[model samples]
Target: MQESVQHKGVTHFTIVKILRTFSPDEMNEFEKFLHSPFFNNHSTILRLYKELKKFYPLFSDKCLTKEHLFSVANKGKSYDDQLLRKYLSRITKLAEEYLSILQMRTEGIRKDYNVLLQLSRRNIKEIYTRKIKKVEKRFNNFQQFEAEHILHKHFFSALKYELLNKDNQIKPHNELLVDSINNLLDYFLIVSGWLLNEIESHSYTYDTGSKRNAVVAPIDRNMIVEFVENAISNLHSEDKDRMIFLEMVLNDMKLSSPESGFSAYTNLKKLVYGNSHKMSRQILQFYLQRMNVYCLLENLRGTHDMHLDLFQNYRKLLEENLFGSEGKTNLRFLEFRGILISALKIKEFEWAEKFINENVKYVDEDLQANVFHYGYSLLRFYTQDYSESLSHNSKIQSGLLPITIDSYILKAKIFYVLGHSDSALSLADSFRHFINLNKLISDFHKQNLLNFLKYFRAIIRLKAKNNIAKAGKLLAELQTSSNTREKKWLIEMTEDLLKLK
Candidate 1:
């Protein structure tokens, strides 16, 4: 049946147009009819709200008038307190009807809110796992579009609220949610950014007249630098209380250019000095030792001044602490060992010998082996002490301690200086074998080893004075394989050996 409505000058026959033109009192009556039990069903609520909202705005001053209220009320029907209490008559009855059914339908899909609350209170990794599962489920499958939408909207909103709230609902669990959220956000940002970069960069080719094509883009160093700077800036200051945190930061910063490392080290040193706490002092020493070790290993002569200055300050700190009754003895020994190495590098042999002799008793088995081997090599090559050096070398080799290539070169040089041609040749042969076994030789040390071997062989030939052919052959090999610095050293040594011949 068609409905008819009269207007000022027109007659409306459609039901929708009649509702759209209804008076405020009539619209209020329609709203009451919509919320009643007769229209409680989802489809009925939706249909009535759709028709009544067009004219209902004129009847209410509230933002979500009767029409909007009806929409939300229908969604809340099974869960709403008033409806559940009136219809189910008991809380258990309502839970059995609605909560149990939803739980069964979405079992193992949504994370348990209670479990999440507990885990968040403790900052457990299990909480992260549960959150990931919940996020995945919300984003993946959906039996009803509305169900999926509500789940995601509410879940994220609740998570954000929990993370930002400072009050401790759980005892002794302050900032746990904040830390977890930061970690998760960082993980997601790093992974998604990498994936996005990989996807956006495409490799393609087009052929034209038998031509090949290529595409290339230079790496952005500035972006990398900015990322590192921002990362350092954002690290939690509380984490700096731990020794491991300072070590990790220093190691990461060291991966930058040498200039960057020096700058960062200076700033970090100042920070540690300013703090002057026990942990800060330990951290400062750790970074100082690490940076100095790297500089020595890389032979970065440019930073020698900075290295010495820092090492001196670190040694003083260690000494002052170690001499005290309650000081750490092991740390004092480490500082003394580092100073000995630095003195050796700068050819301060007297200081090196004095320090080693004074602290030799406190040195452990590992330090004994390293010190004896290195000290023997130095004494033999630089101080020209044959018997004493040989005694130490025999001890190191008998102990089967690992020897560096530089140590082998120094031993060969010592044998040549002592006129033990056979011993020098054997040492050179062992050095060559070591280099061949370790295929990944550093460019700096490779040249140094080649030059040392060449000089040793040349001296042997000079002593024999008749193996001219063998001598020339060795010199030719040195010239062919040598870098610029090595070639100059080889040429000078060859000239002197030829003159002797």
Candidate 2:
């Protein structure tokens, strides 16, 4: 009799989920990893892995039945549920180890650090001294550095000092301990600065008037700002520029409003342009993300024209390939959409089209269709090809919440422009229902979209009536509204109404 097709928890196993994340190359490499005697000794686990590999990528329901797995992996042995479970568990552990090994290969210093620890435990003074000097040399010769490097330097110093003082036959190096403390403080200041930036960025969500949930140590942000400024004045190291950029970011965060943020923003842009080469890719990418956030915040305030600034920021990131590892782009769908929209906002049609074609492939395969259609639809809409725009927009069926909301909004805009008032208003109402029913969208975002719909309905009505004064009033409200999405487009639409009269 053929085995029953029930999955019986095999397909949904954690091993299957982990395997799904592996690329084709990784899958083949994992097979070799399983064959290594050092990593895996169980033959049945290998057999189980072979059975699992038959259905490699999907491991669909019918292929992952418990009965089938047991029979195939243990051809002659009688079915024992506990035994099969043990084999599955063992293989999952092996897979996890393989992943760790992969990570370890990329971090060579981590391996040496552990080796130094092992040497220290054995009190192999001669080899330990030689290895410590080698590692310190490697660290000194390193051209690029991260904040973690400072911490690692401190760790090595501590280890060296301990080794020297272990037997107390000779005095410890007092200078080494001081050097370690200095490195520790540098690490603390850098990490604390980053954390402070994050705290201030999200400070809008907190209610200061609400009762406290717990007693926490109060941080004086102004004190840190003052200390950082003082340090910048006295700094003479290679890290002077990096420290200066951190101070600039902190200053930008200190600005009470987006209107006042422009000076800080300009200073930051100039500093990055001059010192990007001195920074590591990780640091540069992180600060670029913050710069983009500042640009977006200022743009939302409706005072500064930041589209060109945003366009340049994205161009730098893309040119440097900082969004992904190994010289390839791997943008999340939302990030891809934001970049394309930024290019569109600046009317860089040719560059935007080329960017979409070049980078759409970097988005996950499942999201590629929606990203492609949405990008082309925006491009078509901007270039005034309404019919083609609608055609591309209709092709997006990803069921992703943001894509759905954007698709509906784009459809409504196209219909309104084409004089299909009834269809346009109907879609706008449906969009409202979608927003109200969905709990996934945060209150902040929900309010933004609802505000857009409110202004959208007003613009449609104003166009039909050709009320020039009301159009001007609508434009003014949209310009000043801080909590609305699509404010720029709505303002332009309302301006078109004034021209109509």
Candidate 3:
């Protein structure tokens, strides 16, 4: 539609996005769905669907415009503007209906479980019993803690649904049944509490990082944190090996202390490594996700040793064929960044070089340029290829302002290292101005970066004037700052200047 590009492919693109996101198999299934009279009855809608398929992989304006689509859809019949618009509307609804059906079919457990709940509530005894066995079987097939817990939701729901039935002659009040029910309720209470904390934490994380409009949820801050903490403490004696219990512990650590989350991170590693084959793919995926989050947390905290642990963790996930599946780039992209940083942290240039070249191809084309260049630039910089480092990072164009501030700090360091003192000083000044003006950049980050810029500019000045004595005084002042970025690297450079005498 020529209505507005603002809501088009780059943004919303409603029906267009749904169709283009389909896999080859999904597209075929969608075609069958369209042909089935149960989903679509209008001939014009069918014609519209056929016309849209021709623009697959790239639903460009050439064939996607309403004029062309209407012209082709009502070939022999003259196109009535009103009729054409109705045809598009009907076809759009058909596409939406098809997507809903496909999602349920692909993820069938939730649908069947919901139906089981409904059937149990209606006191449809025979069908409810049959569905119960089927649901239990499906739930049992899942080895992930999330699956068990999700099923536990349904399990407890079904138990309550059956319990409420007036037709039930006798209530089974067995100890194991009652105990199991109570435990699941407790586990779910923790899940609910942890979800609340995560929602609140994101509010804080974003509030400190960006100027984006945030919808504040009205809730007590301290109460939820205390609830989750007490829940975890109460549940810790819970089968320690159980996944839901482990997740609650890890999530609490992630929310409260990212650096301290390292211990929780190790516990998750043991669970995955020891029981991956016994676990469902869903649970393995969840474990990998948490591990990566912890990896990032540790990296942000400047914990240097975790660099090697992540290298092995990513390698193991890849070996299991779980790291990147179905051509997804988001996870692979995170792993790429993590591996690159970890490798550079320990100076494993050979492995870093191989990983960068091989893994960049897996990154989505839209993101590869900006994302990989940032990693490659770091690798190049660490390997002493200063020129190429600047060349690669020049194209990085870090998207987030906070990350951009760090990139500028890196660029200044590169310039100084390459003996471009004037450019380095100019860049430091530009960084100071940008940080001062950007209200979006949090005060915490601004102060840290300001400390970096001040000490960095001082070092550049002293080196330029061949004043080693003054450089030492500035380095001591820089060391005293409460928080500073690139502390070790800055100290190393300053010490090098001191050594020249």
Best by lDDT: 2
Q: What C-alpha lDDT does candidate 3 achieve relative to the native structure?
A: 0.66
TM-scores, each model vs. reference: 0.40, 0.85, 0.79
- Residues 1-501 of candidate 2 have per-residue lDDT tens digits of 234434364767889999988889999899999999999887878888888887888888564678788988889877787787888888899999999988989778888899999998888889988999999899888755467677888999888888878857466588889879867866776566567666654443222233365333366556666766776776657766446655654564554344456776777777777777766787778778778877765665556678899889989998888998856669988678778888999899999999999999999998898899999999999888999999999888898776887888889889988999989999999999998987667565677788989999999999888889988998988888876777888888898898886
Candidate 3 C-alpha lDDT tens digits along 130-242 = 77777667656765555545545546554744544546646554643654665575565445544655664354333354457555545443555465566556654645545
Across residues 375-493, which tens digit of lDDT does each residue of candidate 1 receive?
65555544657667766765654322124644575566567667788988988888877765664554444555565665666657665775656666666665555332224335455
- The prediction achieving the highest TM-score against the true structure is 2
* Candidate 1: residue 435 lDDT (0-100): 63
After aligning candidate 1 to the native by TM-score, how far in Å is the CA of 354 from where it should be?
A: 3.2
TM-score of 2: 0.85
lDDT of 2: 0.79
Count of backbone clashes, every candidate in sequence:
0, 0, 0
Better of 2 and 3 by lDDT: 2
Please report how far candidate 3 places residue 468 from its true position, in Å: 5.7
